[model samples]
Target: MTAAPTHASLDPSGFESRHFGIDDIFYSRTDGRGIILAANAVFQRVSVYDWSDLIGAPHNVIRHPDMPRGVFHLMWSILGDGKPFCGYIKNKAEDGSHYWVLAVACPLEDGFLSVRIKPGTEMFRQAQQIYTDLRHRERNENLPPEASSDALLQAFESAGYSDYASFMTKALTEETKHRDIALQRPADWRLRSILSIKEGVKEIEDHAGDVVRIFKQTNQIPYNMRLQAGRLEGTDGPISVISNNHRQMTQSLADAVATFSEKSLLGNDYLIQAEFLHGVSRVQHDLLQSFGLEPVIDGQDKAQEKALLSRQQMEFVSMAHKAVVEVSDRVSAFSKICNDVRRLKAGLEMTRVMCKIERSRIAERVDGLDEIVQQLGKAQTDLDHLLSKMDGAVQQILEAAERLTQSRQRAA
Candidate 1:
């Protein structure tokens, strides 16, 4: 582990950080350049800015100085590509007080919509340190936003993420899980099953790679036997016949095995995308419930903010439902792939038997012919075991996906 970054200048003391309910989720909309378009009552209340002060103002009206410019720079770069941005951000109230949120900014029609939740994860604490480190660099070294963003990504990698996208996926899941714990909500069965399947797929894929490598090693065995046959009694020898037979059987098995890869078995992705998107939909559903619990606004003006919120919530829900269905379909595809792998595993068993028969005839220890058979036997056994485990995992994953697909409509 690396040493913790200093936060000497990023301390929250005398900062008058405002506290919001654990259930509170701030919602807002912004134009391409980040001018505020619409916001929910919670956003208005927490920022201490009235509708008049917030609407049409730059969305940065509440941006806290402590927030690194590089974060916004990174955000715009991602949003420019029409992708969503999820990260922890600090914001300021009109009275100069501050608050933090795990903001998920998603693309909307002609603009963007952001839903924010109060963050309570170890990742959030790490984010604060990174922000402080970047801010310090900007102050002392005059680091540009883009350069700082590159450095930020390296920091994310150091923190165990592969890249920004991976970091955000992990960060979003952690934030959602922590929030659920705080709210005393049990982890959803579908999510748990999906996560388990993801882990199982990784293990299965690794073992599958070993199978391919081991199978490649068998390619030399037949050639070696033919060489020995030539030395002992020319092409007419029993060793030569056994070598030809082994080649035919091994080729057939290799063809069956080569028709697939870890990618094929998992259907393009290992359910990581589905896990995150399903998580997104589930968390958004909870947010909608929270949105409904706020006091109804008075007057036509506040009423309009509430009206916008209602429409945004519905629109977000519709989008979430659509996304979940697509990901679930891909998840179900893995089940079919698993069935195909099971049939292939049977082929592997047949190949192993044929090789064993050939090895039985070669009584002479010709270049350790038995060793080749021994290695093949072990590799086949390992692959078969992994495939058997995959069958069970895929079944569980399919059941979980079905549960979500069936309930998505009612939940939406």
Candidate 2:
């Protein structure tokens, strides 16, 4: 085993970001003492190091200076208990270029096997910020790695994560969902048609949240309109008729908005299921690749075992694709509802504008009519804003769906 580098011996200068392709997966095995024992071709390529340089070096040889020492301390503590650790890691290459990976390390027969892939999720970005803060504390406060680890845990807790494991699991799951769709290749096109679907789900989730907010605001619109209608209850002619019609329109709009909220919630639930399935598929893919099964089997039992595993993987892939299809269907429905809401909002705005014009004609006769008109106008403005946001989100979903269809056609 190689000796671990002392903190003072590690350099932290002259490095730039080095990006690897999304499909690249790096694998390495480390001794119990944290010395690199072996690495795959992808690992060598990304690290810009020869096999000779890596094989006997301490695993931390690739550790980037920007990474918090606290993270490593926590990893070692977990590994000591024979538990696997998963995290977003920033690593340095031999040529002083850095890259980020979502890495999982598990105890193997004699040591540990680690597999890593590019991270492409919002949580990864959050993790990066957290790491930067922890690194800053370690340097500025002259804190030891162990002390920084405590701070790191506190930060995670403050961010609403129950523990490090919870945070890592959620982050990894989300990243996997995004990468599954975005990183599909012609040779290994598992979930190939789902490109950008994860992003679309995120968009829909955001839109749903906006819908909930708009519903709350629109819910009040009818109540206010009813109050105004009561003020004009004793009036005669088209004015009274218009007031009644306005109240009716507002109530109908409110009901439509409520229905939209319900549909968005349902769509969001389906998306969560899709994300879970994608995460499982990613784990299966990584496990299959890490095993590095031989193409030419020499024994009957080994061939049988391989075939069984392949069949299982195929089943998993099919299930994951089905989940993606379900998500696409839900998002399509959700997008259609959003479009209807946009048109409904436009109609509401047109009616409100006509009401204002009529109120202007009787400005001297109606004391509070202007105030009512102003309130309705404000409500219309809020609805328009919400609908605009939803439209953008729906467009994103449609574009992703189109891309998925195109990919399938190409594959066929």
Candidate 3:
């Protein structure tokens, strides 16, 4: 392995901070000994180095003087155990400019894959203070790097993390959440909006699948009710009529639920269209950012025209939101239908009880009265099960709709 660079040998002053874009991710692979093996375009771009200069160099070639040595010691200790390590890192560019990243290093079969992204979180700020204090301890007190590592653990404990592992995990998670929120802002708007809409579409598809399942289960209810009615037709007088009425009511309920499920499927299609339109909007916004020139008299008019066109495109999104509201209404309606089915099942139970009371009178006349009663009981249980599932699915759909509405509000 190549020797680590000394503090005096590396330049530390005169350069401004270089920044990686929110959309940029730097990736590199290092050997087991921490020598760089391969680097991606973003990695090379941010480091201000060519592939030839970076390849085979120690990964710490970009380590900044401001970073505490204890942090690297902890990272290496974790990596030695073949575990992934995540932390906030200050890395020096080839020209001595520095940038901050939330770095995740995962141990691989033959080497390690380290991915880094721009960090703009509160946790990152806390990390900066901790690193600065550790560096101070090392420089002022002449503390060893291992002693600085102990100070790092104390800092994490003081911050409520039980250990380095938990601290790093929370840091990475918070950084990612902050990065996603940043992407939704005007300056950083890009493919992240498209990705978020796609996730919303997936939620719709999942709810639609649940609706299809309940519909299939619901079909059995009407069929069972009709069979029960057929068995009691001639012997039980008005009881047979009550059973037939229930059969028709259940059949109508089944048909209504089927229609509602179709609407949910249609809603899924609308969500997919929304995802596509979000992608288009991201592209248009990125183009505007990339090539927007200074406004002259006629140029300002063109810009206004473009703004008008963008507003018109938002009508598509408005239509998509309307579709979402319709699906939510359908779910509410289906929930009410489930309640009606439950009421009908209760009536069937009462009919079953009456049949039991007149058992001696109709025993010889009705061939399958016992079997029909048993079937009715089983159908009631099945209906209850399906109603429960429908209620849960509707709750999920409502929650998802609220979240989408809030996201749109934020976007506006």
Q: Kindly list the per-residue Cα lDDT of model 1 for residues 1-412, writing each as its tens digit.
A: 3347666756455365555777787677788778887666888888888888888899888888888888999998888887678888988888778889888887766788788888888888888888888889888889899988888888888978877877777788888888888889897676676576566556555655765675577677778777766876699876677678767867766655575554435532435555555555555666567666766644325556556555655564455445445545654665565555565445445545665675567666655556655655776677677766666655665565566567765765
Give, for candidate 2, the lowest lDDT window spanning 10 residues: 1-10
Highest TM-score model number: 1
| Runs with alpha carbons beyond 4 Å of true place in candidate 2 | 1-159, 162-196, 208-233, 252-254, 266-276, 279-302, 339-343, 363-367, 402-412
Rank ordering of all candidates by TM-score, starting from the highest: 1, 2, 3
- Which should have the higher TM-score, number 1 or number 2? 1
Evaluate all candidate structures by whole-model CA lDDT and list the values in order.
0.70, 0.66, 0.62
Tell me how candidate 1 scores on lDDT: 0.70
Q: RMSD to native for every prediction?
A: 3.6, 9.1, 15.2
- Candidate 3's displacement at residue 137, Å, is 0.2
lDDT of 3 by residue, 198-295 (tens): 45435544654664564454445444545555565553555565556655665666665566555444254444444433332333333334324423
Candidate 2, residues 1-412, lDDT tens digits: the string is 3233323313456454564777677667677788986655678778998777888899989988788888988988887787567788888998888888888776654787677888878777677777777787788899898998899899999888878876776776666667667856332333333435656566666766765675465445545555555666545544566656656665667766777777775354444444444454466466557446434322224444344444544554555555656766776787678766776666657656766777766635764666656665776677677667666766666666566556545744
Tell me the spans in candidate 3 whose CA falls farther than 4 Å from its real position. Answer: 1-16, 185-412
- Measure candidate 1: CA RMSD: 3.6
TM-score of each: 0.83, 0.51, 0.44
Clashes of 1: 0
